[model samples]
Target: MKIAILGTGAVGTTIASRLVEIGHQVMIGSRSKTNEKAIEFVQKFDRNISNGTFEEAANFGDIIFNCIKGEFAVGALKSIEKIIDNKILIDVSIPVNTKNGMPFTLIPELCNTNSLGEEIQKNLPNTKVVKTLNTMWSTLMMTPSMLKDGDHTNFICGNDTEAKETVKILLKEIGWKEESIMDLGDITGSRGMESVLHLWWKIWGSTIGTFSIKVVN
Candidate 1:
């Protein structure tokens, strides 16, 4: 499969590397094709992976992963909305306010009543947007075995059932367990999913290493 990762950040790079390792053709996208980080990433990966501008990646990919920072995600995706129409877009970004280089708060305008997932879906109406993987660290997103041998839970929500199923397949390929993944109904569930970051960050500070939750009866 051809995959486009729309960011040069740790999350995007980590996912791009994993996809390439799993034999998928991957493209890392950024604000510009000349971005030093994206270039470095391509150099470090196999020939199956490449780098390009966001628009170019969108056109090149069969599936698009929106890993752009929450603050910039909507605007960046909106710029190439038409190029990604009808493609499955997996959004793993949450709007965060970094104060003194630390993520201190979720964006005020995008909480409770609205969410980044909804915004992306609203802006790219023709694209199928599935929200997942925003609640944990980037490394954990790709290698769930780091915790409980991949037993920890992951969440996914989207308006399109077929799109969500497609994402679930990718999740399994990347080490997530089918029984461990919970479907929170639709894109509106992203509110709670993104909001959970509040608790995630708090737990992160006190924990010795990475941690995630599992729902059990």
Candidate 2:
């Protein structure tokens, strides 16, 4: 599968590397084709991995992962709206804003009324947007077994069932347990999924380590 990662940040790089490791054709895209991190990734990895501008990467892939930071996610995605139509978009971004330099804070307008997942889906109506991996860090996202043998829960939500199924397969490929994945229903569920970041931030600060939720019966 050809995969497009729309960001050259930690999350995007981590995912692109993993997909490449799994033998997928991966491209890490940024605002410019000459992005240092993107170029470094291409130079370091196998030929299956490459770098390009956002639109180039989007057009190159069968699937798209929006790994751009929450603040700029909407604008960045909106820029390549036409190329992404009719493709599955796995949105792992949260809609957030930093306040007083404190990160992980939610944007005032986004709280309660909207979420980055829904906003992206709304703007790109033809794209099959599945919201997942936003609730956890990038490392845990593609390597869940690193923690408690991958027993923790991972949530996914979207309006399209087929898109969700494809994302679920990708999650399983990355080692997420089948039973550990929770289908939170439609895109509106992104509100709660994204809101979890607030508590996630608090938990990270107190523990100073990576941890995740494991739903119990």
Candidate 3:
């Protein structure tokens, strides 16, 4: 499968590298063709990987991963809207505000009542947007098995069933178990997933350790 990763940040790089390692053609996209991170990523991987402008990457992939920061996600994706029609877009970004100090904070305008996922879905109505992995660290996003016995939960929400299934397969490829992935219904459910970041940030700071949620029945 060909995958396009927007952002070139830690999350984007991590996802892109893992996809390439697993034999997928991966493209790292950024606002500019000369983005340092994107260029560095292509150089580092050197095989089965490429870098390009946002529109170029969007046009290149069968599946697109929205790994950019939440604050800038919509705008960045909007720039490539023409090329991403009908594509499955996996959004793993949360609108976080770091200016408040300490454990960082979420921008109320973009979260809580309204989430970045919902906004992105609204903007790109033609694209199938699935929200997942925003609740965990980038490291765990690709290697969920790092947790003891790989017994943990990850959530997914999207408007299209087929698109969600495609994302599920991709998640499994990156080490998520079928049963461990919880489908929280359609796009509106993303409000809950995005809000979890508040608790996640708190727990991450207190424990000083890496962990993921496990839904026990």
Candidate 4:
């Protein structure tokens, strides 16, 4: 798969590195991609990843992963809306503004955690949007274990079955097995799933240490 990574932060770098390691063509998109780590990535892994602007990455990818922050995620796509027709978009974003945020799902989901995924789904009506990878820290995105493998839980919800399946395949390639991941039905569930991140922040941001929730049989 031709994967476009739309941010060069930790999440984007981690995903791109893993995908490239698995022999996928990855284009990393960033505001200024020629900087230190980006240059090092190009030099270190010549065949796997190529750096480009957002427009270049969007056009080059068969599947687009929007790993940018929630603030920039939608705008990044809109800037290149013409290029993202009918493509599978994997959104790893959360909608939280520092000052006015509450829990992921308060009374009526009233937290600053409004529906970021739904917003993206709305933005690119033609594009299939699947929300995953936002619930956990980047440490466990593809890898159930560690940097790129092991056991972890990441909730994925989307309106399109086929698009969801495609993400599942890629998830498998990234070492996620059937029981390790869950599908919470449709894209709107991201509103609730994001609460996991808030819970995580409170724990980690405090001193609760590394914590994970799993479904027990």
Q: Candidate 1: lDDT of 101?
A: 61
In order of appearance, the predictions have TM-scores of 0.97, 0.96, 0.96, 0.86
Estimate, for each residue in 1-217, the C-alpha lDDT of model 4 and write its tens digit: 8999988888888888889988899998887756566667667786868998888888899999988877677788877887887999999877555455664423333234557788788888888999987777675775667632445577899999999999999988988877778899998787877666667777776765455666555
Name the TM-score of candidate 1: 0.97
Clashing pairs in 1: none
Q: How many Å off is the CA of 39 in candidate 2? A: 0.3
Q: For residue 9, what is the lDDT in candidate 3?
A: 90
Clashing pairs in 2: none
Task: List, residue by residue over 1-217, the lDDT tens digit for candidate 1.
Answer: 9999999988999999899988899988999889999998799864899999999999999999999999999999999989999999999998886643666678887889999999899999999999998888999999999999988889999999999999999999999989989999899989999998889988988899889988786
Candidate 2 off by > 4 Å: none
In model 3, the clashing pairs are none
Q: State the weakest 10-residue window (summed lDDT) of model 3.
A: 97-106
Reference-based lDDT, residue 169, model 3: 90
lDDT of each: 0.91, 0.89, 0.89, 0.79
lDDT of prediction 4: 0.79
Off by over 4 Å in 1: 99-103
Clashing residue pairs in all predictions, respectively, total 0, 0, 0, 5
